[model samples]
Target: MPRSPSLRLSVLPLLVSCLVASGALAREAGDTGLRLLHPFATPTPPGAPNGAAYIDITAGEEDVSLVGASSSVSEVVEIHDMSMEDGVMRMRRLERLDVAAGETLMMRPGGGEHLMLIGLEQSLQVGDRFPITLEFAERDSVTLEVQVREAGEEGQAAGQHGH
Candidate 1:
C-alpha cells in the first residue's frame, strides 16, 4: 500500500526537526533544568597564558548561578565579564554569574560574560577538544566538552557544537 502524500510530507518535517535538534547546541545539566549551548573556545597562541571560552546558558523554572568551572587545559577557570566603561574596555572577575528564570546568559567573544582559562597548561589549537566541569551554586555540577574554533565561527553543525 502506498502512503498518502500528506503523510509523507508530515513525516518529512518531523525528520527535519530531529536532525536539527541533533545538530543544535542544547545540553541539559542533569535534572536542574539548566541548558548549556554552543560552548566553544578560540584558539590560543603558543605559550599563551590565558584563553577565553563562551557559551549560551538558559535557565528553566528557577534561576541559576554559575559559580566556577574547571578544565585540564587550564590550571584555573574563572567566570569573568568584559564591558566598555568610559569608552574603555574593562574586564572583571566575577564570583558568580546569575541567570534569571526563563532567561538566557549568552556569552560571546569580544565582550560580555566569558570563561577565563588562566594559567593554561597548554596552548589551545584549532580542532582541539577538552572537557570543562561547571559548578553551580546549590546545584549539581555539569561537565561539557569545549571545542576549539577560530574567532567568529558561529557553530550550528553537529561537530561544531563539541562532544
Candidate 2:
C-alpha cells in the first residue's frame, strides 16, 4: 500500500528525533560529566625525575571526586596539595579531591592542588605532549592530552574560580 505524502512527512520527523535522542543518550552514557580545560605540565630538565601537571576541572550536575590519576610518562601519579604549616611549606598526597556539583576546581602550580608525576620515564620539554587519565569516584575515567609548557607559564590563569 502506498502511504500518503503527509503521513510520510510526519513520520520522518519522528524518526529523526528518535535517532538524535538515541545518539545523545549514547554520548551521555560515556560522558563523565567533567570538563577539563587547559591541561599542561611544566617542562623539566634532562634527567629530572619528577614533574607536575595542572588543569582546571569543572564538575557537572552530580558531585564527583577525583580519586587518583595515571600517566604513561611517570611510574607514580599522585594528587598533591601544598600548604604553609606554621612557617614551613609542606606538600602531601591527597587520597581524593572532591568536586562538588557545579563547582570548578583549579589545579595550579605553587597552589594547594596539583598532580604529582613521580619517577618520570623521560624528561619533559616545552611543547611536548603526553596522555594522562583522571579517575573519578562516580564516573568513568577521563584521559586527556597534557602539553608541556615553560615553568612560569600559567595556563588559564584568569579563569580560576570557585576552587
Candidate 3:
C-alpha cells in the first residue's frame, strides 16, 4: 500500500525541515506522485526589479504540468525559459511546463528553465526564507519554502542571465 497524498503532503514539510536542520543541503516536498526538490533562490541586489528561483521536479506515477506559481516575495511569478537562438540568448514566458511520468524537470541558473520573480518586494538576502506556491494542472497546489543562497553555492551555477 502507498502513502495517502494528504498524509504525505502534511508530513513533508516537517521531514524536509528536519533534514535541513541536520545539515542536508537540499529541501523537498511533494503530494500524490509529484515531488519538488532542491528549491532555492539567489540573493538579489538592492533595488533590483526582479529575482529568480530554481527547482527540480520529479514526476512519480503520473505526468504533471506546472501551470503557475505565486509568492509573497514578489508581485508576480512567471515561468520562463532561456535558450540560445541563432547565437542570441532569448528568454520567453511559458504558459505551462509538463513533466512526463518518471521524468524530472531540472531548473537551474544561467540557462534552460526558471521561475521569474518580477517586481520584487524586497532584496533577497542570503539565508532568507520564504514560501512559494506551485500550481499544477488538475492537481493540488503545494507551497514550498525557498532558501536564499549565493549564486554558485550548493552546486548551483552562478549567472544573472535574462534577469
Residue-by-residue lDDT tens digits, candidate 1, 14-126: 54345334544466554447788877899998999999988889998889999999999999999999999999999999999999989988887889999999999999998
Summarize candidate 3's per-residue lDDT along 64-88 as a digit string, tens digits: 8999999999999999999999999
* Per-model TM-score versus the true fold: 0.78, 0.75, 0.78
Candidate 2 lDDT (Cα, 0 to 1): 0.76
What local lDDT does model 3 show for residue 60? 82
Best model number under lDDT: 3
Q: Using TM-score as the measure, name the better of candidate 1 and candidate 2.
A: 1
* Alpha carbon RMSD to native, model 2: 9.9
Whole-model lDDT values for every prediction = 0.81, 0.76, 0.82
RMSD of 3: 5.6
> What C-alpha lDDT does candidate 3 achieve relative to the native structure?
0.82
